[model samples]
Target: AQTVTQSQPEMSVQEAETVTLSCTYDTSESDYYLFWYKQPPSRQMILVIRQEAYKQQNATENRFSVNFQKAAKSFSLKISDSQLGDAAMYFCAYRGFYGGSQGNLIFGKGTKLSVKP
Candidate 1:
């Protein structure tokens, strides 16, 4: 079974500062997908970014990127130029490319982010 673990329960970053959330996974499959989703108070899951297993280059959005270490089985999200809008519950998820039964994004418990003014 593939599992993801997020050690930090919560984190806070000052406005305009950067924060890196830690994540690690245990998966046997060499090719898979990793994702970071954000959920605000409304509880809507939003994709922050994703990295395909074959890609050595980490994925980066406007203000988000990931540090993916395939050998170590670790993937972490880094948020830059943080804003109050970035404050939310961040989830690290793993997806098995072709799981016959279900297509699910297995999620870590999550790390709540707070942006302080």
Candidate 2:
């Protein structure tokens, strides 16, 4: 079984600053995918970014990017130019690509991010 680990229970960043949330996982599968999901107060899960194990280059989307270290089994999310809207709970999720067509997400404990206005 794959397990996601979040070392930080909470994080905070000043508006316009950058913050990185740490995540690590254990998976015996050679192929898999990683995701950073953000859940705001509304409780809707939004995909922040995703990284495929085969992709050597880390994945990035606008203000969000991931530092994926396959050898170390570490995947962290970096939020740059943070904004008040970025305040939410961020979860690192793992899904096996070798599994069924529809894979289920195994989430970390989540890191609560606070953006100081």
Candidate 3:
């Protein structure tokens, strides 16, 4: 069984600053994918970033990036130059590359991020 954990239940970031959200996971599978999904007030889960277990390079998207430490099973998201629109509930997720639930995303409880002006 695989599980994702977000230690910080809530976070607040001032506008124009950077915020890093912590995440860790436990899994026996060697080949898998980690993801950071953002759900705003509208409740739409948007893909923030993704990292493949085999890839040494961390994944990045615009102001969003991930620090994926495969050996320690840590995957954290860093949001740079945070904005009010970036305020949302961020979830860390996992999916095995090949398995019965290959495409099914197993998510963490989530960390709610509040942006302050």
| Every model's TM-score | 0.96, 0.96, 0.97
Q: Name the runs in model 1 displaced over 4 angstroms.
A: none
lDDT, model 2 = 0.94
In Å, residue 82's CA in model 1 sits off its true spot by 0.6
Angstrom error of the Cα, residue 42, model 3: value is 0.5
The predicted structure with the larger lDDT, 1 or 3, is: 3
User: For candidate 1, lDDT tens digit of each residue in 39-105?
Assistant: 9999899999999989999999999999999999999999999999999999999998887742588
Could you tell me which 10 consecutive residues in candidate 1 have the lowest summed lDDT? 96-105
Considering every candidate listed, which one attains the maximal lDDT? 3
Q: Candidate 3 — what's its lDDT?
A: 0.95
Model 2, residue 109: C-alpha shift (Å): 0.7
RMSD of 3: 0.9
Per-residue accuracy of model 3 over 1-117 as CA lDDT, tens digit each: 789999999999999999999999999889999999999999999988999999999999999999999999999999999999999999999999886876689999999999999
Arrange candidates by TM-score, descending.
3, 1, 2
Off by over 4 Å in 2: none
Alpha carbon lDDT of each predicted model: 0.94, 0.94, 0.95
lDDT (tens digit, per residue) of candidate 2 on 1-117: 789999999999999999999999999887899999999999999998999998999999998999999999999999999999999999999999865732788999999999999
